[model samples]
Target: MGITGTRQAYEFPAGGAPPLGEVRAWLRQQLSDVGRGTMADTELLTTELVTNAHEHADGVAELRVSVASDRDVVRVEVDDRRPHLRPRRVTKQDPTTPHGRGLALVEAISTEWGVATGTEYKTVWAEIPVL
Candidate 1:
């Protein structure tokens, strides 16, 4: 027998902040039957990616999540209208600087992550081993 799962898509307004608690709760529910280790990383990475989209993008952002057991991977992609402003590794002298840590956190937590650019938008995506 094979394990089965699904994918979901969500759209967030341009420059609009998503309620962190609500998003986290929704993810918890979605991955309720999965193991704790997978769920923890998924939630954290999702929050970071979505928050980054809201902060940096000029127009609406979209989130797509896919859960699949065959591949034993949970994938998340956050799409934003600003393709030019790709996430970069910044070395900041002031640790007190309010921004620039999102990608670092994502890189730390996810198994693999990268960026894809289209003419109209860009997507930052991460994948975690779910099995």
Candidate 2:
């Protein structure tokens, strides 16, 4: 059950709109193919994380996912070119605002989340519990 090897993964352009629908579809297909059932929140999780990276760094250089079945956790990370810009916690949600809620949603749902800063790129990662 420990992640001996990679379960599944996908990648996108350095700074481009990652085909959201395709990403979601592929992930769901993979999950189901592996007999892990289906995680309903995956779509939202991917969207929030990807959109957060996209909105901030104009897009992500690449996105990665690693699942540790032993730990029952799925970690998703998005790498961006801007190391200075990291994800911040949003204290409150404004129903009127059209933007600025991705992190809040991410925080609300993720089992654990944080940022990994590198000299050239930064990766925002989140862990989702699997049942």
Highest TM-score scorer: 2
lDDT of 2 by residue, 1-131 (tens): 33324745577755457788887887676555333432566567878888877777878777677677667677778788899986778787788999988888888778888999999999898887776
Cα TM-score of candidate 1: 0.83
Q: Measured by TM-score, how close is model 2 to the native structure?
A: 0.85
Residue-by-residue lDDT tens digits, candidate 1, 41-104: 8898998888887777754477777876777788888888898888876656468888778888
Identify the leading candidate in terms of lDDT: 1
Poorest stretch of ten by lDDT in candidate 2: 30-39
Clashes of each: 0, 1
State each model's CA lDDT, in order: 0.78, 0.74
- Per-candidate TM equals 0.83, 0.85
Q: Which pairs of residues clash in candidate 1, taking residues 3 or more apart in a chain or in different chains?
A: none
Kindly report which residue stretches of model 1 are placed more than 4 angstroms away from their true locations once superposed.
1-5, 13-15, 91-93
After superposing all C-alphas onto the true structure, candidate 2 shows an RMSD in angstroms of 2.7
